[model samples]
Target: MLLEGERDTILKTTSAVLAEHGARREKLIPLLQAVQEQLGYLPKLAMEEIAAALDIPAVEVFGPATFYNSFRLHPPGEHQFKVCMGTACYMIGGQIALDSFERRLQIKPGETTADRRFSLDQVACVGCCSLAPVVVVDNFVEGKVTPTRVDGLILSYESNGQKVEQDSQQTEATNTDEAKGEEGS
Candidate 1:
């Protein structure tokens, strides 16, 4: 189901992308890519709009969308964790790392956290087979990640996230105060 405001944004953005590509069916791939780049994922409504703009069936849009591994149907979480399940990684306890994350985050692969803070996904390979039992957090690969290390990593992310939020709030308050002072002057 699409939220009203998000749906409107998706429709508008998709339309603009189609226009930029001259609304040509040959530009379908680029059209989809542009929409995904803007929205972080391909929302269903956006896909439908793209099909309509190209005068194609929604299934045609959906088929290619699903076929491309890079196109995500759902919005990505603020933090994405990709676990490598390659032969070396699996042999070296990558499964343990994945299980630890599932337990700690309380979400399985291809799912986001309840708080919408994190998402977990498993990849066939990260191309770093040498880094067996590797976990890539936000794009930084952590090699030889153990269950205990997972705990520390989660704690650090949570703590750092909180600190950043607090800092942002403080900065906003300071800015507001300065603005009020200037207005009074």
Candidate 2:
């Protein structure tokens, strides 16, 4: 059930996007992208509307949406946590860090918290190889993150705290110092 304004906006935008792309089978992916970008996630009503617009079956419309990793069926939470599982990070205990986040948050990857506060996901990499076991919290890259640090990070977001921001800076500095120590060793 969409709010009146939301229903109107989605209908208008989906129609405009469909009109711009036309009713071609080849244009399906682009059509889905446009609708998701405008609506945040694909609502059932919007999907049905898109199917009707494109003269395709509803299953045809849903098939690609579910197949693509980029599209989200539900709205995202306020905060998004993406853990990088690159080779360097994984060798340095990325899996453990991910497990820690899952255990602490009580939600597995690709799931949002029941309170709608946080969402967790595992990415192939955040491109911060130096920051092995990196976790991107709301777009801030945290390096050398351990299981203990994951707890503190979640707590910071709770109760209106900004420690996560402060902690990211400290973690970067700490990681740098640790790297120097390893080189000296």
Candidate 3:
């Protein structure tokens, strides 16, 4: 679904961003983010919407969505899963864990399940290298994950309505604290 309330704000922001860049075609990133924020994913229709709004060609907008790994063409899964493959995570068998997920899910990375319950992708780094071999489901990050841990994560969510990983909550708390600290500083 295209997000409505925030879509206007995003539109305003994109328009302002365009005004700042003097409507140059180079400001595509922010434009794309605005469209993504509105549509949840970049609907093919969004290319037309953005092109008309920005006075650019639809191809101009579509090209980047195809070009960037981060862009989404379809509605994202209800839960987005991100695996970190940073040097530290990889050394700790991150690839093995990812393979386990793919095998079990029967869908490759960068693809969403038919039910849209889960979508998986990889990140080069999430800056949580200390938590080597990590996977983040939705917003919850699982640290120090082993290949053996995959089923537990799946079952934990399946059994508990998908909010199973306690570690992710703790990391989110830490992030909030840091955000507060930054504001105070």
Candidate 4:
């Protein structure tokens, strides 16, 4: 559900987009794209408004929205982590790396952190097979990812003035030691 302010913004943006696109049925995909480009995601109310403007059912708007992978119904967080689960990556501990991120961030794939700082996702492939077990952090591909490396990555981001939670401090220490061990091997 969107807050009052967010709902108002969505409505206004959707209205502007509709005005520009002229509510034509043939312009559905382009209109959706324009709205998403402005708002970052398509809100439910915006879709309904689009349906009404186009003289179509809400399901008509929703069908293509849900069908397209490029469309995101939920707003993304400030940071995005897209873990590749391609054949090569999966064979080389990609799932382990994803599990590590989930444990550290306390959020599963396709979900964003409560603070809206981070979002996690799993992609089928990124076409970087040579760099198997890859994790894409905010559009930068991180190759050769591992569970210990996941901890280090999170810590690197959290170290930017945000204090680590008390409970995670011990886990960080343990992970640091484990990273050292892995480096020596």
Query: Considering every candidate listed, which one attains the maximal TM-score?
Result: 4
Select the stronger candidate by TM-score from 3 and 4: 4
Taken over the whole model, the C-alpha lDDT of each candidate is 0.81, 0.82, 0.72, 0.85
Q: What is the C-alpha lDDT profile of model 4 across 1-185, one tens digit per residue?
A: 46559988999999999999889999999999999999988888999999999999999999999999888877787778899999999999999999999999998887778777788889999999899899888857778887866776677666662333432455568878889999999
Kindly indicate the candidate among 1 and 3 with the higher TM-score. Answer: 1
Q: Give the better candidate number (2 or 4) by lDDT.
A: 4
**Best-first order by lDDT:** 4, 2, 1, 3
- Candidate 1 is scored at a TM of 0.71
Per-residue C-alpha lDDT of model 2 across residues 33-143, encoded as one tens digit per residue: 888888777766778887887788999989988888898776566788888898999999899999998998898887778776888888997788998989999868888
Where does model 3 exceed 4 Å of error?
Answer: 1-31, 48-60, 166-185
Which portions of model 2 miss their true places by more than 4 Å? 1-9, 161-163, 167-185
Q: What TM-score goes with each of the models?
A: 0.71, 0.75, 0.63, 0.76
The sequence of per-residue lDDT tens digits that candidate 1 reaches over residues 1-185 is 45459778888898888878878888888989999999988988888888888899999999999998888876777888888999999999999999999999998887777566788888888888887888888857777788866766666677664433343345457668889999999
User: What count of clashes does model 3 give?
Assistant: 0
- Best by the lDDT measure: 4
lDDT of 3 at 148: 55
Across 21-114, the per-residue lDDT of candidate 3 in tens digits comes to 4454666777677657755666666556567767888898888898987788766777776788889999998898898888867777877777
| Pairs clashing within candidate 3 | none
